[model samples]
Target: MERQRFDSHQEHPPAWISGYHLVYIQEGEGIMRVDGDPLLLKSGKVVLLKPDCCIEMEVRSGKPLFLYDFSFTYTMISDKPRQAEKVALSTGHHMLSAKAAVQLSLLLEQLEQRQGIEEPLAQWKQSILFQECMHLVLSDPVSSEETGGTREAIEKVLLYLQEHYRGDISLKEVAHMHGISASNFSGVFKKHVGLNPLDYVTQLRIAQAQRKLKASQPIELVAREVGFKDPLYFSRIFKRTVGVTPSIYRKHRHTDKIITLLPHLNDYLLALEVKPFATLPYGGNDHINGYLPYLARELQETKLTGSWNKPDMDELVEAQPGLILGSNWFPINLETVKKIAPTIPIILRDDWQSLLLDFARFFGKGDEWKLWMRRYEQKVMQAKSLLSLSHSSRESVMILTVTCSEYRVYGGRRQLGKVLYEDLQLTPPAGITTKAHYVCVNLEQIQAMNPDHIFLTTNNSNPSKEQIKNLKETKAWSSLRAVQKNQVYEVESWLNGHAPIKHSLSIDVAIDHLAANRQKPWEAIGM
Candidate 1:
């Protein structure tokens, strides 16, 4: 490992290096070429080189540059039984996350400190640290000019895989057709898609199997049709992924009594007209009791299992639910939940459309889902037409949520923002271009954006309400154009989750507020 520093700008003469090389830029800007492929460099950029690659570099004139150049030779073991093989690293530039950059910096520093050590123990430690550095670089998604072709190839390959997943497909053959090696194709495929190529194939097969099983297809026939040769092996994989055997899933696909562990997910089940057998309690001293106010009417018949922190295990067992729905927000012990019933802990992605479709397909309610979407789309069209009549569609809007601690500004991708910015085609305030779920902002930042209208919601707690009350009294709040125009409106906190029912309800809330005469400041502005 070598830490190379250029105190002053200089063009380096081209040189050839042996073994695999990793060049990490620590600071400053420059351009480096590996075999005439220009790689722009800055902080956190890495340049990987295959053995005997010609290297050339130029630092930005008058700027100091610091980088680490590490070289090593290694071979990877093959997954195939009785096969050991060597795989070369794909040479290119890659970008690292800030956290990973910091980690790599420290590892390189340690390796450099002990570079001269010859003792076996010290050498072993150095080897371990070098391996760690290699893992960090190789594991990162490749980002380079050289990788552009690889990315395009992988995308076409992905489409091909999806189109022919049910056939007897060999990933190696597919990679060869795309002009990429089998091993390299796996890494690139995973970078584009979130799963390994083989795992993706399995997922596609199982999803098809599920649809077939629900249609009363024989187990062996279903397995063979979906690319699985062994029925017993298929059953094991199915049980592991779906949390129930194929027979059990098919039997209870339509008749399962479900218990919802997450508060917001109740809206999803109810939207599909599947009333949950039971649900966890929702409110505290500051909001409506029992469940979310918007969903409470429909969920009245559903049993309240317990509070989120302390669920009633006895009631869960007594409900005899065939399944339990949980989410990333509220975690429960997998073993504990499985002991009662098959549990599906969904990872919430703040995408209501996809969530609704997935649940609809899972429950064999595809037609119901399509019908629901048609109605929702009709509602959206009506709302958009109404807003256009009032010219509110042309105005920029902002959605802000206040908790006891801080104020959050939602972006176009989350909560009410999705309805306003995407569905209704309303403009967002200037300088608010983030696609993230939200960003915390101060009153001064909010004043700077100076949106045409503001929609505010608060946490259920009284202290949160008090914070909103206090915010209204501040000079920063009083000076806003929306406040002066009386365009500020109070909305429900329940409108903030990405549930299908809640998303539809939020559109109603938005249109009602956007088209109405601005209510008096004292009438109903905040909590």
Candidate 2:
């Protein structure tokens, strides 16, 4: 072992070396790129580099990097390799605790002291010290279930797999992408993810295939779309993983007593005209937006399910929904939920129209979705006509929601934002879908925007009288044209949305508040 310092790139090291090298940092910082993935390097961090792995570092300019480095090669029992073999092994990097840092210092000191040993007996003693030091240097379990290692990283990887399973993804590519060894990544991935990495990928493809199959996509097209080059092979894996051929799963998918967890799923189900058996518990939370009042009333006779992201195993089994419409937040392992019912994990994206169609396919409700769409279009025309007469000239509209002690301004693409800006032919004074879908701003900032009109939604079941009285008294609130003209008013609660029906209803509500003020926050619920 040796301590060294490098001030610049003048001394260019090879991209990678022959075997594993354990480098323990003492000072300075740099950015290390492994197979093009950048990882931050800092004091007390130890990086274990594997054989043939591409690595490059960008050191902090004018700062020297000080560290101890050692390298070793491993061989299986009863055999000695003449050249390094491409075998799967574990490698990791970590920040050391003070106790571990001290031990590493001592190990390095012992190795430095024994560098000149020549006697056979002395050599044996030196070998023992080397092994002990190596153990201390490489003892961390980067991806081990026994160590209860970081689970968040693995979950991120799982979500990536869910989103991109149709692409040509390999275990080695993912392991390297995350800066870990293939073997270790495989072990922990299976342990926490409940399937072998490749198996998980395969199941994801099969699930997508099932969706396409239900939609009546050709078998060959489904195979190609899901990354399989051969239709027969895809069918084989499909049957093996799902216990049914793609044809069978398509012919019949679990479709009754539906439950949706995320707003997108809930909205899509509502759009299909088949009320879900249950939905996420939102009525009591500080999220009095959207059509939850309607959902709450619907769920009175129906069951009220917990959030899909949080798995309450007993509660889920008891609810016994025949089909569960889940989002990415759903549990990775649905073994228990599967025992009670089929759980289809739907990855929610920003496009809601496509989302509604996908839900229709899953539940065999394409006809119903068509009927709803036809009616929704008719309703849209009626709304447009009503607005054109009562509210002409593309009036500037803003949607500001009150929650807790803060306020959130919705972007043009948000549920009700779409209704006002798209269907009802209004203008968003605050740019269309410009900010994050939801942007938090204070009262002064709202005054700066000074929208001509504001459709406020509060998380409170109804805006409190005291709060209302106090807000109006503020000079910032009184100066806006919306407040002066008494045009700032609460529309319907819009918490449960992201589907066609919700947007359709919100379109009506937006028109009512804008053109007629029938359900005005001050009068409808006495806000």
Candidate 3:
């Protein structure tokens, strides 16, 4: 056996004796002519050749091919004839014997040692050793179980399904591809792969759908992209597999305010639909800027408004608002606001979703509010389902909010953390809170938690390279799995603070960065 490493710029072999040859692609992808058939070879892939078998190579442009090539001849041992046979097969392609690699390595070492030696005895010994190696190589049994016919068939189906998942691929077509009847193929496939053909395809479709959803594509577009003609049908299937609608899934993935309002619309409406004269006094601070003014304007445009903005206490005796929309941030005196508009209803829009719902209710076109509300509900439910699944799956994460002086480790109260754990279905660290924007924690707490990923958010102040390096080098931080795996992600505070539509996109970026190294398919889906 003889071996040599070939570079991208190396000259082709001269027209000469082509005996048993084996090539291992270490890096780069290319096309190789094996036995006169063009075979695609990717990195970490290998090929084998027989005597007089024509072989050629074509590397992808800009990607120089790196390969290990071995050529050898075999002689009969103990009067037994040598024969070539397939060893391993994957997706219709066969692989050479595993020992081929070992033999090739040793042969390469021998050739290197005799680089300039042309002595007849040394050459004879090399030839004999090469023959002996080839004899041992060819004599090894091709494990029928390793690349069995059934495995080949299954791989073929998997590849085909992956390639045509967005098209109309039927069971009959798959079965016919392998020259088997649908019924027989179904039985064999199920017995061997543990899933019926259709179920397998659906699973693949769901995986693709999850990816598309995480990418923030609209549910309808995701349905169409995944080959589902009916968005409702797609929703049903997605809910069945993921236990949430796609819209909800996308919404829940982010810690936006909309997720909160989705589940509490009735409460919101109940608070908003009060009689003006019977309303309580709004006691919030007048200095605060709430959505009240905007709501009042919208109500007036819709023919349902009155002196609702900056109303005086005496106004309670005369004209009153039909409704009062307020939130936790409402600065007006809640008592005074309600009392001045006694007949008006006061609705609290504290959560992000509630604000959207409130806006839709007052400003949306006729019946459009209802549609929007329903969509919001779907989004929330989907998020809840994902959170439940993530919990069940035992996937863990860490949420960190970056600030100017130090980073704040949200301990379960931050809306973003809640959304990650309770909506998107990720198992956030138990200490993280969602009650406020973010909280501060030292490196000691992080080391103890040993989270799989760290979700970090930064304000206008970006951490300098030195700051990041110092943080990573801290004694308490060095022990953290996330840090060890380089999973520390810097997020923008605006994403975690503002309720703008762009918040959803920010959440996606955070998930992708935090879950960059996660191994599970769902984590990858979130990414």
Candidate 4:
């Protein structure tokens, strides 16, 4: 047994195993890819690796990994009288209980101490400790569940296929690993995972290809990224699966039948003048069929596809959408959704301007974004001119979001904060010093800053109504200069969404309240 400590974010070179190996994670967490299948490495978790397996280990960033590694050959006593035969153990991972892990560590320590001791008594003691360690491994309930049943084995194979599908995977080699014929394994895997091994691989590859295409990546490069060698063949397969040519799909010119799994993504589709075929509700209640009041007019004809968390799959199927846009936060299963239509998981950033540009470029609406930005800049200039008369640039503005339970103060980086501090070029309260997104504060902290203006809003409507009412009754709230001057503007709570439509609407609302101007030319164009 060797104690191995790997540095943070370190990736070990790929090594082929000559004997059976077991790794007991002593501290930290990471991933170990065995024959191209990833296994999560965490504290108290043990992994068994079989002979001839290729393995690579990677530690997560800022987290150093420590493991107790044991490698040996195995000989089992057979049921036959006085017979011993070599046997191979299965490859899988199991979580060890805290008590069992501690006992195993003690046994390993004793065995390590006995290493290199050539005396007969020392060798005998080492053998006993090794046997005790093996007993602890074999007796583990989770380990037995991982390696004992055919169903469990098939599940592991499914996960392996899901991770390595982009690589060149062979049905014969996969079947051989399970000690079965290719035909038999295919039938069993199809029964369990709902698709044959090869078909499942194709589905995974094509799903990834659709995401790359949406990002405006080159067809040739996208092909190579998803395991396709020939760009022409990739295009043909893409057309066959997606019902449009690759170029047309990338340009987003073929269909308007798009489904947005998240509500704010609807704002992006609308800004591009592409009405979504279906969308999820905006607020918490799934049964309410709620849409953001600002976006309701544009989405009136669009179908409501239930909640984002648990979308009605039948509604999605009936829509016959050519594409589905979603984010990582959506709880719907990606594989199941991909079966209905091509789904792209969006990576969201805090900057709404960049997100708008990304969406515009994705849908071949760069000219539209440029046109919209011109109108937006015109509106910003007008609003800034009006603000210059009523307020100075050095005066502080605070965006305080009240929920039922807490208060969150936004700095210059947040959506609403960008409109006030960045777009309008106003100042943030002295209390908000960090570069983090938003900071949770108490009433005492709010009283200390005493900004010139305060934009008060709830995270969502109804829940914080009483909270806001009670807050206004406080002495600290009544003593503020902004409160005395009637500068506490209660704006729409839905301004929390980070989207182009939200940004435009926020500016309109801010100008309306702060400068007493109701002009909404920027919002008019999108509507």
Best by lDDT: 1
TM, every model: 0.56, 0.48, 0.31, 0.52
| Residue 172 displacement in candidate 3 (angstroms) | 60
Q: Rank the candidates by TM-score, best first.
A: 1, 4, 2, 3
Cα RMSD of predicted structure 3: 19.4
As for lDDT, the candidate ahead, 2 or 3, is 2
TM-score of 2: 0.48
Per-residue lDDT of candidate 4, residues 153-182 (tens digit): 575676677678778998899888866667
- How would the candidate models be sorted by lDDT, starting from the highest? 1, 4, 2, 3
Give the Å shift of residue 52 in candidate 1. 78
After superposing candidate 2 on the true structure, give the runs of residues whose Cα lies further than 4 Å from its correct spot: 1-255, 262-264, 285-291, 296-300, 305-312, 318-321, 329-340, 430-436, 461-469, 516-527
lDDT against the true structure, per candidate, is 0.77, 0.65, 0.51, 0.75
lDDT per residue for candidate 3 within 1-527, as digits (tens), equals: 33334445666552334665656564454566655555666443455565665566766423366666666444333423455543332112344443454444345445556656799988887676655545554455555643576655765676577668888988898888866667788887786556988888887787677767767888889999988999999999877765446775565433211211111222233233311222222122221122222123222322212232333445433443433434443344566555532212234332555454434333211133333333333333333333344322355677775444676665434356645654455666756544545556666766767787777655434453345557766777777877777776765444454332323343455444543332232221121
Write candidate 1's Cα lDDT for 232-295 as tens digits. 9999988766656788778767654888888788877777878888888886552345877877
Best by TM-score: 1
Of the two candidates 2 and 3, the one with more favorable TM-score, higher being better, is 2
Candidate 1 pairs with clashing backbones: none
10 residues in a row with least lDDT, candidate 1: 518-527
